[model samples]
Target: MVIKSSMRRSVRILLVGDRGVGKTSLILSLVSEEFPEDVPSKAEEITIPADVTPEQVPTHIVDYSAAEQSEESLCEEMQRAHVICVVYSVDDEDTLDRVTTRWLPLVRDCCSDCRVPVILVGNKVDLVDYSTIDAVYAIMEDFPEVESCIECSAKTLKNISEMFYYAQKAVLHPTLPLYVIDQQDLTEGCKKALKRIFKICDVDNDGILNDAELNAFQRLCFNAPLQPQVLEDVKAVVQRNCPDGIAADGITLTGFLFLHCLFIQRGRNETTWTVLRKFGYNDSLQMSRDYLHPSIRIPAGCTTELSHKGHQFVSSLFERYDKDKDGALSPKEIDNLFSSCPAPLWGPDFHRTVTTNAHGWITLNGFICQWVLVTLLDLSRALEYFAYLGYNTSEKDNQLSAIQVTREKRLDLAKKQSSRNVYQCHVIGPQNSGKSMFCRSFIGHTLEKTFAPELAGNPQCTVNVVQVYGQEKYLVLRDIDVRNVSDPLLPAEVQCDVACLVYDVSNPKSFEYSARIYLKYFVESKIPVLIVANKNDQEEVSQEYLLQPSDFCSRHKLPPPHPFSASNKIKRDVFVKLATMAAFPRFHAAWILFYKTRHMKQLGFLRGDSVVWWKAGLGLAAATAIGLFVVKVLKTDKS
Candidate 1:
């Protein structure tokens, strides 16, 4: 049998097991109408349709006759296989033992990333007894790598097709990618091309691909001539980013766009998880405690820096692999490296190339120059690794909990950084705690330096609400006197962007008072805050006096107190920079919105506030915005 790309999509199915376990018979029965009694003299390929619920996949079943060959050769075959079928005879218990002891190890060694799916098949079940079958089924459950176990008979054609079906499903819809693709240098053309393919493939014009359309589109665009049986391979990609059922086909437009981007594209598109796993990240998402943390150890920040000084790192890496100090990687050493549980950062193609070039002996130069992939630390690159690390194949949650958690943290950071304009900084502290002096530093005192040095000896308590203008575009500092210990924080009414909590470190009572107030009001406020430990330059201020506020901050889960000396220009300058950074995101967000609407204004579509009012319901939005602002300011001043 010869496999053809005539179907909508194709899945590569490789059969592996101990010799004489009916592996050849299984392939022959599924693809051909008649069974051959004698062994075929050469390799054969069979094309058959496997129904994969809502879609049919055209499978390429290769009857592997070289199972008894050298392990290196066996690995080459495993490298090409998308899904592996581990075959054993139900009548022969020893064949099953060979599966756990022999075949599984070779399969794992060959398929390093563990991306390929495996099906445990007990073949020739037609000749087996019930008790024997039951015992085999019980044993199959113990192997986590074996996705599903089934009894089949090639002669009777019992579950032969079903066994192949499982293989296709494993390839198209495995729990996670074998290697995460992090496209650091992704081009606009590549992204646009992928998008165009998805749109073109949605031939039905309904904005999504059904089973037939997806297969046709994949064939036309990627030139992946997979039949309907394996076209369901796109289902996993489709359903991943697709929305709720559209057009009875679950595949969404966005999902189609990213299908190849996530799975096939190498380089920047690859993930950190796969890269680290190659370097040996355990199944528990941990490394040896002795190993340096990835954030620090991996030369992720400067790939160019690593590339420039890479020879030294390469020498160190090669020393680990080149056993016996031969200055070369032998076939057995390469096999041992590949056979390790963690998947290779580079996949089978790289392995094959290395083996082919050195004639099965990898020179140290070849190992480093070709095989070692440098990890880059970038948001897109890191996210790809997180997607794989957070993945749980057994549970089909939204991209996995770990990915979601990481995404939220990154998004929050992005949101805070983007919208920096119009931010409010509420300066809270005990009376006479230099909160007013701190606010003054942002305005005229820093620029004009008008504050008298003598006034430092007799600091005035904040009497009324004082507002100091920061850079007009960035922020406004609101100095409120929180003298009344019983006053409510008004956190719900006043949504401040930054909370500047000041305390005089020279005065222990002020430090204690600030901590009490923070614990009472701001602990659960969900506001980004800075603890200002003031009077840091005072000669009498002891180490603990300055450090005590940090302790309070730590206990309250707040950021470490920023040591400040009002008279010190350097510390004041740092405070100014921090304030600017906190407020810059809002300013940037407004600037972006203004430019984004320039085209609308050029088209004379600027309808102003009334249009927004009408569209967003003027009564509710206007009332709420105004009400909140007034209530917050008034309540804050009163408190």
Candidate 2:
């Protein structure tokens, strides 16, 4: 889907068209491969997001049926609606005519508040000649209201995304990069990717993540996903360091911090460092630091021959008229200096149409484009240099092996931060120490649906962790009821990576029980555990049931218990960290189940729902031995 840059969330697009035109078949062919001939009229929610930055427009599409009026409900589905695409098969000229006359006015009236971005889609264009497609594009230009036009065949899946891209540009901001994902619709692959992304962002290791976690996760995947300044949470490093402003100077320490957050939010994942290495930072941190600072003063004397060379080779300035002028091309000439080797200057495949002739002398558009390329190269260079520093690079290109995992500690740290392991985490907190509350808090308020007044006040209504799309991360939650812990519907033999045993600080009894159940019954030797003391908001947490992190960790025989409040208005980042702290127990349990009952099931790595015995019998045996030893030691010598 085409979206304005820095859209944190995916867009949902609805495609409405006639049946034989292969509406369902088209969307499915590009996104989901299994397209049955007979598609029942239904509305499916699709999320397609590309380009991420605060204040950037994110395109959303919702595809539906035109024939089945009730089925076409994108108007009610996608909020703050942008574009509505009216799909028609080029093979059927009749449907095309109907779109301009009927569908156009219908959609316009339906979404009267904003001018809906309309894409007059000509589907099944693969069968038509190239000129025929061009005619369709031209015909669309006549529709003054029509933002853009494109011909795509859903059957052969030709340029399907380009159609959506044009539609998104009409209503949303135009400057954003058009994210042409193979398929932006909700599909098996998208779901899988969502799962992976969720796992990476849930840094605190909880089954879910909050807003801070979500933002951080995005930062980890792609740097500059959105404009950094708009992101309130990610403060500018320079802002912090240079509050007074460095209008005439290089970047300060504070600027780096903002950049740091940008990197985490939008940096290259496993290979971000690799991207930085390509841009001349080399292997020296000192040199990289210097470029960031720009130590050399601006030339006062451009007449010098050495200054002239610097301008040509480094700045790419004034080769045009500066025959005698060298590195010291006048600042005015520097503006158009990059025309010499526009394509090859960046090595290869620069794809930038902007050049010396770009955007008046400033060539703002071209400059921005070049900056993006240079940034990518810089990232490549920095990443490569960092990798080499971590691992020995013996090649001329000095390439570091792009191995996801490595034996070295630095690489391991990088992997942990960049690539997260997807695991089933269990929340094992006490009766009301806020286990359920923590889950809700972790998901956050943005995604929570408000209930009708009747249902809101009704008792016995609760949102269980069956499976939820987390606000910050996407995860499947399984809330093990108190009675169902030992025999969870999931599986009797399954063990989870963590069992986040929680206790309410206000209620001492519940806290005690939660701790015991987490250590003795729920966890085995193979499984690790984390204890959490939820309800920090309550006065009793500190005044009555006081416990330090170290004390709690020692008492539970687990990692220090994270104490926090899960009431409404939670700090998203802090909450996510607490959840991750609780993830240990769940991870341990998952592994135990996998080892103990290996043959129970093996769902595909990407999509798995079968029972896994993460809790191994061998683990239980080891725990039993330790228990027996303790009993023997406690026995009185009454014989």
Candidate 3:
């Protein structure tokens, strides 16, 4: 079990009952190993070291007597006590009668806000040959805080240590939180917590804990694997008791919860408590903050991303949930994937934000990309879901191992190449400039398929995998909404790995909006800029500005305006260009020259025995080679 730092360091047990119930003798007997003949009205506080206790927690024993301590003092000790021991003489009926009538009521009155567990200690049992266990059990049902009833004789040292052990156990692993005596079943809170654990252990989402998953869960909680025979024996026990508990030769959720309830019923509350604490649950059955959000520091200019281990784990999880053997996860499969979480982290808008298949199902690539997006944008939330999704292993103690902080962006720029696999591009344009369609097209959605009425009002962000120089990289396109020409872009909106300024070729005024946005945001920034003329299939009109799109891009030393038409087939090369620009921000001019030369060759402008075209292509290729050489020399000199 993992002990939280927030838990109490010591267990305080206060003995409160009628004065002649041998409470003082019980304390002295455990300390000196012998009952004192001349006992005082009250014994001084006794402390037990942690090493000597079964719970490995320091214990403080307090004795209460009406002759030595005032009522206020008794109430103060009662309030401070972690667990209260209600001592009663087995031979004396009046002492047992006052247990429910006086001492138990006083404990409730003093600590009304917080329920403290109580152990009913029947001291001086040697004085009577009869047993009062039945009478004590009746009173226990009335006061739910009472954990257990044990009879021991202080004079004979009978259960002298056992009584204190039970007292300590009551405070450390109390049964009140896990079980209810009246209903003979687990409490609602305990059931809910165990259900979550059951869901997490059911790795295949089949609603059953197979042999492999059960052993894995065993190793996780107990630090040791279970024997084959022992596993079968446990299943047998659950099957004999509850008929519906076993299913498909494995333990169902009903069986899982039944085992925990059985543990609490058989005075084995520590078993359930151990499982709960190992899974980051506290005494109240709520997930602790430290476990949900472990401490992770990201220095200035650095971003967070999933490590290789994180990617592997999430990939395996997706495969486990993809029951249909398809490449994507349906809505039901997605729901099962996040069933262990408190609520679904991704909402209806998630489909519109990430790359989806033709059926609008989230693909494996899209699933990983979404995690990457969350890790970069909101790390705390990612850590929270990491905990929720059971992202833990024996090799790693916390979620920190699943995440990695990238190097400073400035360092990547200084190196002229980024080692990062994900890049963000803000697609800034006017409302009618095909901004939304442009962003969606990056994820393989064409203009005809973009009119989804269900996803109309969703956030304008789409992520997809792109190949940049034979390396797979994720490119995130965020459509920046500009209400009017006078509306200025926020600093957050302006910041990105690359800026894509889109304009409608058919709209005369659309180019002016793109121009003004670029001049205002990208002119003085180090971020690479790409100008795109959307709606190229329509009739092109001259822009109502001082310069056309092509001339403006050239004047600003930006990439030439690339024509795009989502009305026809969507070209993926444009996205590749954007990702390449973002990957090597400092080598933009070289990349532009290199791509231009490659485009000329791909279009066969230098082929077909055309001397003029061949000469032009040769001149462009030589110039591109020289530009790349100069950029390389400058980079080497700087390094």
Among all candidates shown, the one with the greatest TM-score: 3
Regions more than 4 Å wrong, model 1: 1-10, 33-43, 47-58, 67-71, 111-116, 172-639
Each candidate's TM vs. the true structure?
0.32, 0.26, 0.90
Per-residue error (Å), model 3, residue 625 = 15
The parts of candidate 2 lying over 4 Å away from their true place are 1-8, 33-38, 48-61, 70-80, 130-139, 165-172, 175-639
In order, the Cα lDDT scores of the candidates are 0.51, 0.41, 0.84
List model 3 lDDT by residue over 459-486, tens digit each: 7678888986666888889888887879
lDDT of 2 by residue, 82-188 (tens): 55567778877888777767777676566665444566677877777743456555544454345456677766667765666555444433211111122212223
lDDT-based ranking: 3, 1, 2
Full ranking by TM-score: 3, 1, 2
lDDT of 1 by residue, 1-639 (tens): 111111226777788887788888887777674566776633477665556332366677776665446667668878777778988888888988888788877766766664456788888877966535556555445544555568888888988867776666555543222222133222343344344334434444456677776555444434566675566555654565454423365466456445544553332222322333332233233332322222322221112112212334345545655666777766666554433223433433332222223343556644643322222213233323322322211123322222111112234344444222224467788777777766655532332343445224322211111211222222345666556768776643245556777877777577766666666766765556677877667643533334476556565555466666656463444344345434332232222222233233321134555454243333433433554466468669977
> How many clashing pairs does model 3 include?
0
Clash counts for all predictions: 36, 88, 0
Model 2: how far is 40 from its true place, Å? 3.4
